[model samples]
Target: MRCHKLVAYSVSAAAMVTLVAAGDAWEIKSQNKLVKHCANREGYDVCNIVLDISDTHALCSVCRLNRTIPDLAKPENRLRWSKLEQAKRRLLIGLMDLHLPLEAPVRGYSRGLCFDFLEDQRSNSDVAQKFITTGHRDGVITINILEADDVQRVWQREHVGERYRTLLGHMRHEVGHYYFELIVSDREGFGQIFGDVDTAYEKALKNYYARGPLPGWEQSHISAYASAHPAEDWAECFAHYLHMADTLETATAHRLIEQFSEQGDFEQLLLLWDRFSASLNEVNRSLGLSDAYPFVITPIVKNKLRFIHSAIARYVGLQL
Candidate 1:
């Protein structure tokens, strides 16, 4: 059995995270502290543990979106949720850094976002479903806590014949679906590149599962699963764009590359990603690990990425 220490904190007019049992008088106070006693607020034992903590800042904005968390009665579930939160923080931070939309939808629109880290029958027999799929709907991204388990995640990846899969990859892919709803709306060049967007998702996915993605899926889609549907194609491309953006930013931050920019030159970004990913793959090989990036970005996939790049530029600034 595991136990957590409870701490009370208050930050006037900003936010406060009161660590206590749910349904308590102070439930839903702020964030992060909901799981642990670290509210990032002053006067708490854990306050100022990191340079990021300050009196002006209380519960982090990222932890505020969590609608549900795993059952902490099991020690492994806590670690799994920790992994999920880490990846989720990276995802939300990356999107916010790009000046993209992060607000959870207020009314019938994708203006905001939320997350639900849930478990199903696989982890608990009393749960509702046998499996919990990682997906996005109406601005809520649901991730199965099992995805945090490396052994299980790796089994699923190979069973599904995926070339690349990771906790961050799943977050990027699902958020791509969320952003697709926000970014593409009767926009020009979408259909020209991603093909029809009106295909019935259920039927299309049913066929995709039964027969698998079409042959030569590599020539056009970013991954075999991207060929499952037009929507998925857009999501895969969007995820790749995010990978490029985040990795490029990291490379620069670490001084791995002196020249990197997210402005104006999409072509230049592509060139940088090609070289960086190549070096990254080589480094993995030196470590006797698999390639960091296994798939090649074909011309069609590049066009889709280009469309996403332009959409993001428009999203960030009203650029043409």
Candidate 2:
């Protein structure tokens, strides 16, 4: 579905006060507000508010989807969970901005989404699990809490030979898998764009690990990992699409672009992204940091991303 452009809201203190009539409305307030406030786990003041409901301390919609969180008895786990929540919230914000459905799995919808934030033995020796791979199954996305640790994530990124790795990237990529089941699994022509998913996943992954990505993989895939299988390709492409859409929306909101419309000319958006991403990389380089986005969009990858856009358009009931 075509994403709706967010309407800017200008809320002055007076306007806020007016909306808080009878204290029945939600009002963005300072964290220091000792009365009562529903603050998002992510440190976003915009999402922090004073709810007028009886259960004013209730978790926000995004936080409520977390099926399990790491044990808080361990002080470090709290910080790790917070980092994961920050990334998850960003992913949810992107989906919500696009007007996509986001029901919890407990709602009984087959496509309902949920998350399990866990820590493996690597992070918590008390855990029985020796390892936990970040993945999606059914409607649940399991993320290893260790991904939130900067040193650990960088070490793993280097070990896996990844140009970029991040908790947000992991969340985006896994949600891509979840949406594949939601939007593309039973759709016609899915195979034509992403190739046959009927291929045995275990065998394909084993072979991919043995051989790595094919030589000249960039000509067709967005990342070497995307060449692992048809499903992986689709998920990777979908992740990139989310990255582009969210980044562009943020840039537009910051007035980096004069105007932006997700449903506007697709090619035009790509062109604008090319210029913006290049400048973004240059800015990062100026700071002696790695490129924010390390992959190039070849024609084949662009087609895959276009397919993702079309699927999202259909999912949101947008007439494209």
The candidate scoring highest on lDDT is 1
Instruction: Give the alpha-carbon lDDT of every model.
Output: 0.76, 0.75
By TM-score, how accurate is candidate 1? 0.82
Q: Number of clashes in every candidate structure? A: 5, 2
lDDT of 1 by residue, 19-50 (tens): 44654223434554333223533332223122
RMSD to native, candidate 1: 7.5
Q: Identify the candidate with maximal TM-score.
A: 2
**Tens-digit lDDT string for candidate 2 (1-320):** 26542211111121222122224333334322222234552243334323334554555555668798888788787788878877887798788777667774422346578999988888888889999999998778999999989999999999989998999999889988777866663445778766888789999999989989978888989999998999899888888888998899999989998777776667877898898999999999999998998889998888888788777777667422
> Candidate 1 — which residues are off by over 4 angstroms?
1-58, 105-111
